[model samples]
Target: MSVDGDPVSETPTIKEGTWEAIALASAVMLIVWMFIAAGWIILAGEIELAQKRTAVAAAFVTAGAAVVTFCTVIWRGKINERQTNTARDQLRATEEANWAKLLQDGAALVFDSQTGKQSAGLASLEAVVQTQHRLFAKQAMNLIADYLEQVHPTDHRSPLAIAAIDALGSGHSLGFQAARSLKFEGPNKDNKRFAPRSIWVPILGVRLVRYYGGRMDTQYPHFNEACRHSTFEKVYFSKASIKDMSDFESCFFRNCKIEEIGYMIQENTFQSCDFSGAVNFGIESIDDMPDLRPRNNFYWSDRPPIGVTEIDWASRIISVPSQFSNVFAGERLMTKEGRDFIADEVLNLQRHSN
Candidate 1:
């Protein structure tokens, strides 16, 4: 009538009650039939036919009960499974909604007038990428890039632009069509655009370039890792610095002008790289040579700096530190043939330089 102190009114559905009643009636009838058969056997003195009939009836009753129990179990299992799937779907939807709201809030902060709020927005986007929310991060990156492209550059550092650059630098990969050209249009445009300054645009360890075609004019834009096979057609880099201090590094440059550049790294082969309009190279010594070390000592080591192996000829042209000299000497002297080979390559590069 009741279970666990709950009323029995809600316990049974129509189908469940029907099956329960059938089972109870069948059990009672089976007991009565057995007693009747026993009485008949005692009165009629061992009736074999009657015993066979009783056994057959008992088997049919047992089979019917088994079928009812099995159907009930299967129906309950299906109901439970449907409930579980519905719950999972609801949870997934809720999570997606939360992420969308977070992205909206971050975008609002980015466009805020306050510098602190803008920084917080950038930090939020960075957190998205760092946490492996690839879709959300990519969308945010595109929005930031577009905003940076539209805004005009100012004499003072623009916080929004800086934040955008920081976001782009933080990402491991980027995707967007490059701008056709970069120009400074306002008064003192030349000074603003081509000033002899050291601007920080650090993109240190990005390995993937989903899209890379742009007329970049930023000074001292650092690319310390591989950014090979991207085209820069008719780009201008007046007093710019490009450095790559790692192995198998390469990039592309086509019809680009350079007043003075510090290509102070090693083994960076520039494919189809042209420097027809380049100046300051005819001088005896170059100044403001770009250093290939990471900005902070947190990334520094005692290992010989980047261009050591590729620009081994620098030892002859400039003073070489004892540590680097020792390593180079040992490597060159590994065999008489190796020593001869290095000498020949160095001489070849020197001749070409002149």
Candidate 2:
């Protein structure tokens, strides 16, 4: 203890204070506090009733401290207490390490074995996801995606798989920030986002995928690097929850029933997709409505939704080539400022004669 009441040092780190030093400090503090109380009580003695009451209170406190000091010495003095704490910490570390191993070896438990331990593995994976640490939780999420994709192509998944899929898709288990790191594919099979580290896994990252009819009864499924090149047709999104940050690029979607979706489909393109089945479309625009992702084009096959239908279709906020103006004039969601951008701007597709 120094003259100043700053108990903690300025540059304090976890590795501060040896157990011996800490114990000594505690004992010194205890003694000093007790002495001050005793001195105060004596100095105020034989005075006013308030002073007498204060002295009695001080006496009680000193007695309590004496009891505590005795107990400390008998039941594992400071050294023993410190040792017990160290042991407890070590135990916790061991448990964490074990869980992390289960996280890393998740595929074996999930994909491998017939002892009904597959469910156990999924449970372990969920455990890792619960922690939501970028290291283990991200990998756990990636594994969860792998398991879902393995069963996604087909209509049915084991109850265990469905449960796991929902836990992940809903993003209820992994929290907000971690859920955004999720990916269906990457730039190449060999990479992940710069924030977290991951290895190449099938369905982890791919450029293009053309999905045919399949019942995608899942939650919050997203494709990363393959958005533009992926195509989904006759896919039924049953109970599927599309989050706010989702993106769908030039990929064609036909006869797809998007049962439930809440997202920002920005300067993205939708040429011949039916919007009748799409539900829960979010009202907030990702950008300032007409700024970023400027190359947006919407050509819905059905009547557009409310927020989208209100787009200033006739407003030409930005100038575009007169010929291109004729190309997008009929689009229900196109705004004038949005008109300045064209499909070929991002997709690099050659423009066809209007």
Candidate 3:
């Protein structure tokens, strides 16, 4: 610039420190640029490494979740099996305990029976039967019947015997065998210690004896002898095969129903004995020789008679015949006309005898 013009020499005189200050500024800027480039490169490498580590961690987490799911399924199955086995064992143990208790109770009942405690024994037997153990109840019934027939023959009319009879009646099939062996006879003459006894036991469903091809008397020997002067209250003989009933006399029958008795009953006294359903003997003419009069002797009655009164058929003024209103009330074998005819015959006989 000074060589071109006249003011070149004056302009060529430089500023005091302008060139040095510019060089210093350029150096400082170059060092700053280098540092920035180096930092950017390091940061880029670190971000790439972090992304790889994150993918590896994600893979590990997914594998771990699958393992946990499989282990949980297996563990639950094992637990359920263990619980099922435990419940089965408990049920088996309970059944065993129940069986043991039943055996123990049966033994105890036998002991009571053998120790002369018949009332207590029968009560225990009844309790066992009420438990609905059919086999055990049947066995117990058989044992009691055998005991009564073999050991307690002379123990008729005892409260224990009565209870045993009631127990026997409650059974279905086992009672029949026991009832057959029962001896309902007058007392033995050799054993004067025993009173002149009758069968005070209340018999129910005696018609079942017919199934064994025999009448009640044939099945139970001396039954007629026991029936004499004995009160048979609420006895049922429905559809029974009674061939010969000639010995049924001097007995009191209350609310007894007879269906198909295979005989012409002529001598038996009926006191509320219902023959309306008696198909065989309903039309048979009853004989008057054996005193076919209603025996009012009873152990218990709804309408209890006053005092020790005997029903006298000799007098025309008599208590109303129980058979007229109760037994023969409906359309049965003994019609109203038949009843009237029989009554007139009885009155005529009474007058002739007097």
Clashing pairs in 3: 2-8
lDDT, ranked from best to worst: 2, 3, 1
Whole-model lDDT per candidate: 0.42, 0.45, 0.42
Write model 2 residue lDDT over 1-354, tens digit each, in one string.
Answer: 432122445884332244445445566766876677667766765769548767677776677677556555544455566688799769867867876798867767877655366677778787777765556766677676666556433433356655665556434323422232222332222211122111121122223444434333333235332233344433323222232224433222322333333443442323323233244356344333433212232323233334552343222112233333223465324345434354444343333212
Task: Note the residue pairs that clash in candidate 1.
Answer: none
| Per-residue lDDT value at 230 in model 2 | 47
Higher-lDDT candidate of 1 and 2? 2
Q: What's the CA error at residue 282 for candidate 3, in Å? A: 8.2
Q: Flag the better candidate by TM-score, 2 or 3.
A: 3
Off by over 4 Å in 2: 1-81, 113-115, 131-134, 170-172, 176-354
The candidate, 1 or 3, that scores higher on TM-score is 1
Best by lDDT: 2
- TM-score of model 2 relative to the true fold? 0.38
